[model samples]
Target chain A: MPLPSSIAALTAALSKLPGIGPRSAERIALHLVQSESGAVSQLADAIVAARVKVHLCTTCGALTEISPCEICASPRRDASLVCVVERPVDILSVDKGGTFHGKFHVLGGKISPLDGVEPEDLRIAELEARLQAEPIQELIIALGTDVEGDATSYYLAKRLARAGLKITRIAHGLPAGTGLEFADELTLSRALEGRRELS
Target chain B: MPLPSSIAALTAALSKLPGIGPRSAERIALHLVQSESGAVSQLADAIVAARVKVHLCTTCGALTEISPCEICASPRRDASLVCVVERPVDILSVDKGGTFHGKFHVLGGKISPLDGVEPEDLRIAELEARLQAEPIQELIIALGTDVEGDATSYYLAKRLARAGLKITRIAHGLPAGTGLEFADELTLSRALEGRRELS
Candidate 1:
């Protein structure tokens, strides 16, 4: 069915997502209209509600419905141990590991030199403020391993190391359950570099 | 910038497009508001316009802005020849080849036993009606090579053969530029089966 003007408008509006093209946007718009009347309305409601209800957590810059956010508000989380990440999606991955019970700080983006993004443009000022204000003992840099990630890590490491806080880099290695033969050269090399005594 | 309720509603609506998840939807919604406001509104207008203006061509079930569609209305196209396809996108591929200048019949979908889809569920009745009403000389079947596609093709072939039409199947072979050595088992088998002598 050809969509209503408003619906088509909405579809065109949706084409802005990271990878969605025009055809995909049209297909999605049609699917939403066809399948879920309530869901469509809910999505509309959510968009409005989220935009109004959600804001970046002032403490960590993570997108949240609440001011302090659930993680920040929780007393169970170790405020002394903080994990610094590049994005909110990275938080989900770290949480799934079930190893870390610390708080998080989202930098929003990495320092990309080619893309004209610099350290000053990111949430570095906020991060430094947190370090000065909070009684944090250890700061784990859980940033990505890209070229920009390396620059950001090195920059953050040098800055934080001067503060006398126990700063540590997240260990890099082959993914669990991945075959040795299928591993990329860089990952294999990293695994070899980080090897420990079996004992 | 904060989105207005109406714009947010539209953004939410657009995110449901195929391959678009939640994050992409927000990005798109934001993008639409920020840039190409006129073009975005026009896209919305097109959807509404298409919805109101376009209808299924009563002759072949292809959605068209016009009643019979340009292809169906064109006298230059072969009236006695028909190409059967699963969807409208398939028309682009055939059109790109610039080979077929005949009429088209959109079947909508193929029979999938596992999915409870049957021939009775599709446009088979309409197809039969078209064959009975028109003086179609050749029926060229162009469906996908999936199991469901094969089943549908075989069923259609048997039915068309019984009707005494000069039915032909689109030749199946390795995709253009794919190396013979890297060909999958099923593709290699198909290539061998569809082999021809250069007489």
Candidate 2:
């Protein structure tokens, strides 16, 4: 009596993803029918394979097929200078910049008491444990400048500073190529405060 | 050197989907690993299962796990009244409205001479063949209001407006709940022209 159950079901499933509304889900589901026959099959297979095999790295909380992940296993990365991030996605963004030869640690989330998130809710304990076990020297906090990110950075900076480790918050400012007039007051203020003399 | 090859490959694969850029793909791939372990597997399995089994219905062109699709197979639908549409998504949309009790004929595409789309490129032959075999009375065209859709409709109307049967186009106008001031001039003019007398 209803529409072809397969289409209805596929549309329903596609709608569950973030930013995909009903119209978009319908478009995608319909396109799946007419697209390269094997493309959808391969996508499905990839999803299953990724789901079954990928696991969080025990050391840094990054998604990996192996327990330690590739970055953790690499001998070349500086283990002493670890860049701390809020999520695994942040790791890729930092890695893509190709500037940091140091390692990474994903906290999984920020400290947002408003959303019922706390230090205990994140990987704070795991980070502390890693610092204790490894010969870590400097911890770089690469969290966002949002309220929760600010709170988390403050908490980590205070805690790590007390533990006799050098803690540095990644400098926040207007992104490169952004015009000064377009920059918000907070970003302009941060840019001014974090300014360093060019060598 | 990088993340797990499979994780990277999957991220790359997901990026190919509509509206999903590199960043969104990475986030989705990572989200799958960290959250909803069971659902991710289910989605993967469903994707493959649907892809392997689903095909277009020869009668209506809706995607179905079975041939002919449910609507084409249903005797309750008015086989004499066939609604012609551009894509399978339109069929699902009209079906959702629960207004039409007729069957569907999907053209798969519209007539876009500039874009290299012609009547031969669509399922026009199939539609003509169906008219000969079946006792069709009315042919209703419901396509997008784009240039291609208009050209296709005009072409089809000239070709299929036989001596006995009635061929009609769905009325175009302002969408429900939209204000006249906000409506585009063309749409408002069309709405005025298509207005019916209140009995």
Candidate 3:
């Protein structure tokens, strides 16, 4: 016989999660059913709690339990510098390095005309508002170097251009700790062009 | 700032699931938090409902929504034959083939002396009780071909030996659609030894 209908339903719901396919969904569902009841209940509760409690920061658009988020409210962070990213999750990737103490803004998505995404569809207007209200002196666009990323960065640099505000995109070069053989053609060329002579 | 405490909790809970590591768990947590509120709540509800509703069939220890399970209650199944599996989930794997109309019994685990899983720890007593009460004539041991599986199968065969009762194990050979070259030494030897004279 097939799995019990309830287990099947659990598997279907789990399959909706990112990175979990039908086979893995089935395995996890079966495992969860036979696991400790308390652990299963706790997992369910955690899902609901995260969904109900987490919200985007009003100022920076980063995920947070509070309105302004810890980064936006922190006086220790560099308020004059704002790092812009494509998705909210990118904030976590950059912050994990613990080097960037600047504020952040999630652009929601890059300008992908092929997929019908436009600048207006992103959170660009909100970013402009933040720049006007805050003392932001520099905008670090930490986006991919793909076609969409390049187009979006170019458009933003031109549109948000002003007398004082400086705009720059993250460097596109060979990743650290990777061998030269692993670097793709485009990455090698970019690394060559972005080279600087140490005095 | 790091992820909100609620999101962190959700990521931790997700990481505990099988096949999900820290990176994928964080990705899923972020996706779920951004997904529609209705879908997230439905997923949470499905997990709790499945965990609360589904249970092990008391008769065979297979996962079921009811006491006897559909297989045990059905009249169309072959009541005179039973398939013994290592875990409740293994029942699904065998039954999915649709050729096994016989009932099933989950041994909970195989006998592994190295792991301290003795015969007494498994559901052998329950199988014995079923055999005594039911009119079963054959017991098909659907288990892996690992060292533990072979030992358990041999032990069960010797222990359950009786007049008018037959105990057998599933075949060990090259899997269907696989080339002969893919078969390992042990599987090739077993297949060669079990070869029959076709008319």
Best by DockQ: 3
Number of the top-ranking candidate, with lDDT as the measure? 3
Q: Chain A of model 2, TM-score against the native?
A: 0.93
Poorly placed runs, candidate 2 (over 4 Å): A112-121, A162-164, A179-199, B65-70, B73-79, B93-101, B110-129, B143-162, B169-199
- Candidate 1's C-alpha runs over 4 A off are A1-54, A112-115, A146-151, A157-164, A172-199, B1-55, B110-120, B128-135, B143-167, B171-199
Tens digits of per-residue lDDT, candidate 2, B19-136, equal 7788777777777766687788667765655566678788878777777788888899998999999887678788888889999999999988888987899998999999998889
Predicted candidate 1, C-alpha RMSD? 7.0
DockQ for each candidate?
0.12, 0.42, 0.81
Q: Model 3: runs farther than 4 Å from truth?
A: A113-116, A177-189, B179-182
Chain A TM-scores in order: 0.87, 0.93, 0.97
Candidate 3 structure quality by residue, lDDT tens digits, B1-199: 7789998999999999999999999999999999999999999888888889999899999899998988888899998999999988888889889888999998989899899999999999999999999999999998889999999999999998889889999988778999888999999999988787899
Residue-level error in angstroms, candidate 1, position A164: 6.5
Candidate 2 vs candidate 3: the DockQ winner is: 3
Candidate 1, residue A80: the lDDT equals: 92
Query: Candidate 2 has which clashing residue pairs, if any?
Result: none
The residue pairs that clash in candidate 3, if any, are none
Can you tell me the CAPRI class of model 1? Answer: incorrect
lDDT of 1 by residue, B1-199 (tens): 1233444565567555567567666666554443444555454444443344545577886656566777778898898898899876566568768878898898879899788888888888898898998888889999999998898998998877745578887988888987998888998999999999989
